[model samples]
Target: MPANNLRRIHSLDGLKLVMVLCIVWWHCMPRVVFGYSLPDLGARCCEVFFLVSGFLEGYRHGLNYKFTFEELWLKAKSKLKRIYPEHAFFLVLSILVGVTSGKEWAVLSDSNVISAICNALLIQAWIPSFAMQFNGLSWFLSSLFFCYLLTPLVAYIALKAKRPVGVWHLLVATMACRVLLEAECAKHPDIYSMVNIHENPLVRLLEYSFAYYLALVYRGRLGADTCSKKVSFLWSVVECVAIGFALYCVVEFNGAWPRWMYTLVFSGVVVIVAGERGILSSLLGCKPMRYLSVYQMQIYISHAVFYSLGWALFPTSSVMAHVSLFVLIVIYCFAVNCLKRIRQNKPKPTVTESFYF
Candidate 1:
């Protein structure tokens, strides 16, 4: 198979930027979504996120999910390179923000430091203290790291009995689990109760597993990329309409819906549509978008720092503050990119033309 199908698609970069936008909105605006709160959406967005991973991994690794432990570890190293530097930067920054704010730095104690040492490894989400208590954006790092860790195994099972059948099974099992869990929670609906479900390792694993598997079955095997521009364009519009309907159904003027999973279902589908290139290729691949998509993760990490500081300095909520956020983050990104480019131009050891690692 041509690697074009397996390689990371340009549109998916756009999809990630969209995910970050959703995250930022959820973080900044809570009342807009009834009384559910911002953190709720932040956590819930994980549902669609992990599913996208399934889709990408399944697509990237091909029909055969089998890989040696070493192979998995090799991939893990590449992931570490991409994620850890930014994580460390923000981890220290978050602590500085908490400490220098003259607030009681409880998470800075000896015991907490010890715990954070382990958490810095980015392995466990089961620990209560580590949950959004320190290094908030580390949530995505830990989640993606965990997803990368399990890709080989997820791929293996997903590739069996033909790809689609396996993926359909995964999807059915996942939705069924969600339905059952929600039905059981219909009575309690307490934050703690929902937290318990969210913390359940099995649930998180299954959710992310389906994400990677979806990418494999649908984007990979379906050859949605091979579709003509016209059909893909039409499908994109339909996906948007479905997304609009889903939003309308869930986001009532009076209050949020009793079950928010409808948004999850709809958003997940809409996101996949966004990832389809021929559908939105021209726009998503445009220069500005390509630029935005490239540095999006950097923007994500840095934006929070600016927003938190801006909030303290301004000490007021206004539309200009939000607008200023976009301007400041763009300036920060450009400056960082320029610095990186200068570094790339620095002197380095010369190598022969035919040299190989």
Candidate 2:
């Protein structure tokens, strides 16, 4: 399979929309989606995001495994270009929104000022105390940036592996390490809480690494054979089953399932979704889902800002306010996208010199 085809997987876009919407609802909704309120759907949605991000990064690198310092620098630069501008814009906007609401201390307090610096440098998520401040959702961005920092090394390992199964073995080892760490943390609950373990970028990097290796395996599998109708149908069946299992976990476990199980279930769902040939894929690939997918990041990051506004305006009108805020965010993102397009389309100045002069 060509990289371009992998990139064009419409099912992935639909999946992205699902993840984004789930996160938004989890944050903005008054009540929980599933029967049990223990494990937020939003948390699972983040796992999907992390895995998908790692997979896409690996896919983009294609078969190239060797990385020079220059290549790593380029990769870092590219990721920064994609994320930083919008992130900075929203960071400032969030602060401004707070200040305008007579909450200057939220942005200007000593702790928050320190948090803003950490968030800007993408290190806020690494510290336990600093993890969820500022834009509470922004820790994901910082953690993702950490993954990007390790992309070159991950690519190098994937490229140099003896076989695809080696990548699988690596995933096993990584998970084992994670479990061992959890056990150690369990012994000293006061010192090593879940917040201490889960919130760190270094720990999340282990999860990201698993996803990176999985992408290598997936790409190899994807290229090895063209799925016949029967195989495709079977995979679709698997996809449906995966989704059902996830829902079951949500209800049965009440979000109390082990972390590793959560990772495994969502990773399975992601694989099925990325297969991109199922009936479920066709529905997710629809125009509205795909359109919303284009602004998925915008929706994810900017929703918090408007969330505050929504609650303030409709303190008594929960459902109506939340929905209206969502619509407004979508419109805001659409307008921003349009403006960016127009800016890019504008002609650049040309410089010329007269030979006689």
Per candidate, the number of residue pairs that clash is 8, 0
Number of colliding residue pairs in model 1: 8
Candidate 2: segments with Cα more than 4 A from true spot: 1-7, 32-38, 63-65, 100-107, 193-198, 223-232, 313-320, 346-357
**Ten residues in sequence with the least summed lDDT for candidate 2:** 348-357
Model 2 agreement with the true structure over 285-340: per-residue lDDT tens digits: 66677665777777888888788777666768878778768787978776767665
| Top TM-score model | 2
TM-score between model 2 and native = 0.86
Q: What is the Å distance of residue 43 in model 2 from its true position?
A: 1.1
Q: Rate the local accuracy (lDDT) of all candidates.
A: 0.58, 0.71
Model 1, 1-357: lDDT tens digits are 543544345455555566677777766544445656333455545555565555555555655534787788788897887778767776777667666554343345886676567458885355545555555556556656776787777666765646457677876776677666656666566643533444444456666665665665556445456432443666667666765665455445223443336425643663445455344544554456556666766667766666665565565765666777677778876775665557668443221110100
